[model samples]
Target chain A: MFPPRSQRILLAVLAASALLSAVSGRLNPYFLDVALGAGISVVLASSLNLINGFTGQFSLGHAGFMAVGAYASAMLTTTLAPRLGLSANLLQWVFFPLSLVAGGLLAALAGVAVGAPSLRLKGDYLAIVTLGFGEIIKVVLQNVDAVGASRGLTGIPSHTNFFWVFGSAAVTVYVVWALLNSTYGRGFLAVADDEVAAEAMGLNTTGYKITAFVVGAFFAGVAGGLYAHLKGYLNPGGFSFDKSIEIVVMVILGGMGRHSGVVVAALLLTVLTESLRQTGAFRMIVYSVLLIVLMLTRPQGLFVWPLWSKKEGRP
Target chain B: MNRSVSGPRSRRSFLTLAACSAVLAGCREKDGDTGAQAIRLGLFGALSGSEAGLGQYTDMGATLALEEVNAAGGVLGRRLEMVREDNRTMAGESATAVKKLLSRDQVVAVIGDGNSGRCLEAGPLCQAAGVPMVSPAATNPKVTEIGDCIFRVCFTDPFQGAVMARFARETLHLSKVGLLVDASAPYSLGLASVFRERFAAEGGTVVSEQRFSGGDKDFRAQLTALKSAGIEAVFAPSYYHSGGLILRQARDLGFDGPMLGSDGWEAPELLEVAGRTAEGSYFPVHFSPENTDPLVAGFLDRFRRRFGKPPTGVSALAFDTLQLIADALRRAGSAEPPAIRAALASTREFQGITGRISMDSGRNARKPAVIIGVRDGAFRFLRVVDPGDPGRASS
Candidate 1:
């Protein structure tokens, strides 16, 4: 099922460089813009899928973590890229992905801080907490000086394009999907099924829960970093509860806990939002109407995938 | 406009009017399938959302300008066709909309992004594409700093802040000042920063300062602090919604100081919310309908006939922006983007409905601001200030 390790690395390099070269040409800005948006959505949905779908954390503050990651990454690139004084070519190759990593790691840390307290809560209560946390993040960013306050940090080098977004998306899917297949991944499923039973079975449910949040936070951070660079702009207004709800819709519209389904849903919704530009004033209204129809028809999502290839429900 | 006094009109002017209308009809019909001979322009704004009003007014201004151009036998024998895009008032979304205009619709010159945030977002994209974009009312200084291809027709924040500061210090002749700034708003903060700097530079003392966030209903605490400071006047650079509430609260605390504000106090809600408390408030603005200049009156009548209402400051600036673009196109003698950019940069003493606009090196418009006073439930034009030159503070 797997290619040889050296060959896989060589293929990945070839694909990335090819994408870069293609984008360097007069790639249709219209299609590239919509496709880049779709790629970011894919990352966000899949990351949120980890906590809400696989581990059953049901986070409503995914946008807050995204904001943190975006601001952190934006600050790094805008500040450090200039100070490095390197050639433009070297800067793009070296510092671009480094900022994303920096953003993701910071978001993972934020997950630990917030998840440590609120993980004890369940269901709707947890949702409410996460929602509040999201608003708090926006407010804090607005008041902070380093991030340009409410004006938001502009002049961010527009580095996000097809290669970085799709590559990061691929990495997010592989890491999450691979994690879900490990022995520790079984603990996550057990916790989601029943906490009491999983605890009685000697599973460290709390540890697994935190792991899910950190992992989810990491990819969401990556998504935020890409988003910050894609628009070459960042604003707290873009990361409100509306953003969180939009991501949740993408997750639920696909099958919960289904990675491939989430990717498809993200692509569909992103492209739809862009393609409906011709609808004028009724574009968003039409988007909502279509989504409602989809929900009413296929409530469990378009793709329903079993987590494991087994007949039994749980361990 | 010149009809004969007698029952039988003169034939010469009648023929001219008929020719004008026919040319206008031709311009309006140029959007037909041929698609070859017309110059394509683009317009983008908050076409739908909470701020849709601004976008609608922008469209109206451009529509009027286009009608004038088309009526005058079109531009270089090519009728101007606008490819309008609704930016939806988001930074990334506006960029995407402009990108579509650049790639798909392929507009030569773009105008719009009435607000600063979206202008800042879309400016660099236009620069990269070598398209000229002129913002009608983006007052933020950073909008033009993106590149040479980006420009705006409104006075930047620093100029606006200094205008208000000078008015509060020289025009109103007040020395001791109290400042109230909204910490959460970029406009308010930028305005407050400059007002503070220039107020100090102008040798006026700022006795006390207070801060509040947007949507905070209660301002008694900040008012009490400013009132107790015994300042002569209060400068509250905030939105009308919050400004109205703050005025009410300040009065309840018995601070009768002269309350000054920026264009954020443009809405009518300040009167409804603050009631009689809103009287005597002073603020700097882009346009006032009460001006008696012939240019102002002429445009006012045309705007009324077209949009069914007097143009607000936002719309007036937008109208001037389009006229300014048309002026540049006429001078450049070509539809090329780079040539248009050069022509726009060299514009000086261009008679817009608002005022004469000249471009600075930063691509920001060097223009004067009008400070108006609220008296007897109406806006009274008070004084005009040009902050770039202190000698021309009032003209």
Candidate 2:
């Protein structure tokens, strides 16, 4: 197995090279575009795993965070990037990272606000709350006139590249992985395993749960920001309930607690969805069948084993 | 006992090996690339979801165009290849499809994003990457406003709104109008704005304006408000799916007033959805494809032969847009973005199934809008409004 640090560094280098190649027009623009999409999905799926897998929260409002990120990043880049009068090269470097962070921060704030009340609930109630939150975000966004409301925000400078997308995904994975391996991560797992026991253990269960929720939302928001720039447009429809479910599906299918599982699932699912398009009208039916079959055959998911599985009987 | 243990162990190993071989074989077969040399054009639409009919019809239209273009030695001696991607009516998926089309397929251009919101999301990426996109049916002005690289064949909401307004004032001779709009839809909101602005300008009063969401099935509250306002004509600018439900519900609620809408009511399903209530409703469309013009007749004949049904307004617009792109390519003599944009901007008097096509300063098609009224469960052409007489009363 590769060292975690070196694996991350290697991934970063590969992503940087891809971005450079794309901007220089040396790489196939189409492949670069697909890479960017896969990268964004990786960010979304992995972040959502933190809440659904590690914290054992059943939130389905991933798209709400994405919307927050998209709108926030769009407003920042469009409103602030121009005033700064930064050179094109500098703007490319600075605004991309700034938008990602802004998106994450705004999403985190939204997560905290939503999670404060909903986190206290359990099972279907929490799911309903998160689903409702996602719908509310879409509805509120549809009416906010400053960002063009239902008409959507246009004329966003297209600065999202392969590097920006994969780099952010890498950072999200690293952060989430590191957090999962630390005391906070243990607290999250404990809450997931048994909330009552976790609280009995003197752990601030609510605090840990909320932290995971916020962090997960933050990464989702960052992915949304990357998506907005990559598409060069922002619309509420992009962050609808259907989108939230897609991310959740990714996390579940990748095996909730497994990091590489999420990554592989994101890539495989993305490719499968695209390939299924060639099957004409029956594609969706076939996809649904496949999902059902997979569930029945492999209930624990394809990659159920966590990369850093604790030594047997140690816990 | 030892022999028995060896036999069981060998059987287990054999099964595992067979499963591995099966997986490997499946992967290899699926990974094979059937290489074809053609200019791959990506088509994104809600192909397999709630809006499957819309996407299927669009695919048919695009396929017809692609087949015809290829039959004629293709564009620039290369066959036109269509790489279809289903958005499932989700904007995020649409964006992802756009990326895949641009990066993986290396498509020359993209066509047929039926929904306005999806187009709005995907248009910018195309513009940024300098890949020309021609949306056949996305009518919201915001889609093209993204950049110069984006072009749409269909008229914007402003044009359709004016058409509906003219029909209401002149053809229907209704001075008092009620606007029942889907506030959640960019298309509906835009049309409502323009229709209200132009109707009032033409010495008509928008007596009542009621709002509803896209998924709203019941407009009883809004209709009740309109009924109290004593409006003679109702303008409901929304997609046929929702418009049919509203019309059916309104008729059930004793609304007998003439209803007017934009091209969103151009689906055949409208008749089935609204039943007899949809009759007498007027809507403006880009084309009917039922015209007697030889070129249009030829297209309709070919479309019927291929798809076994009459094409809707969207299908015609999509077909025309593809043709327009081909025409522009011929005129520009190159597939480069700047050349094509310049060629597209200078387009004038180009005969399209819709009408004599031209471009205004806003890069919108400057073609005449055709008003079609539902008569006997079929679209009957009422009149065609020219761009010259913007204020000509239909009567």
lDDT of each: 0.80, 0.77
**Tens-digit lDDT track of model 1 for B1-395:** 00110102233223223322432332232233437788889999998876889898888888888888888988888898887888666556887888888987778899967888788778888999999999998877778888999988888766778888878877778889998999878778888878887888888988998999887999988888888898988899989999999888887888887899988898788888998888878888888888778888998899899878877777788888888888888999999999999999999978887777888777878777888888888668877776655222211
Q: Could you give the CAPRI-style class of model 1?
A: incorrect
Provide interface RMSD per model, one decimal: 27.4, 11.5
Model 1: DockQ against the native? 0.11
The DockQ values of the predictions, listed in order, are 0.11, 0.18
Please write out the lDDT profile of model 2 over residues A54-114, one tens digit for every residue: 7888989999999999889988889988998889988778877887798899999999999
Query: What is candidate 2's TM-score against the reference?
Result: 0.78
Cα lDDT tens digits for candidate 1, A102-192 = 9999999999998888888988999998899889999999778688877678889878867787777767766776677667787777788
The C-alpha stretches of model 2 lying farther than 4 A from their native spots are A1-25, A271-298, A304-315, B1-42, B72-81, B99-108, B128-131, B165-260, B264-281, B289-301, B330-340, B374-379, B387-395
As for model 2, its CA RMSD to the true structure in angstroms is 7.5
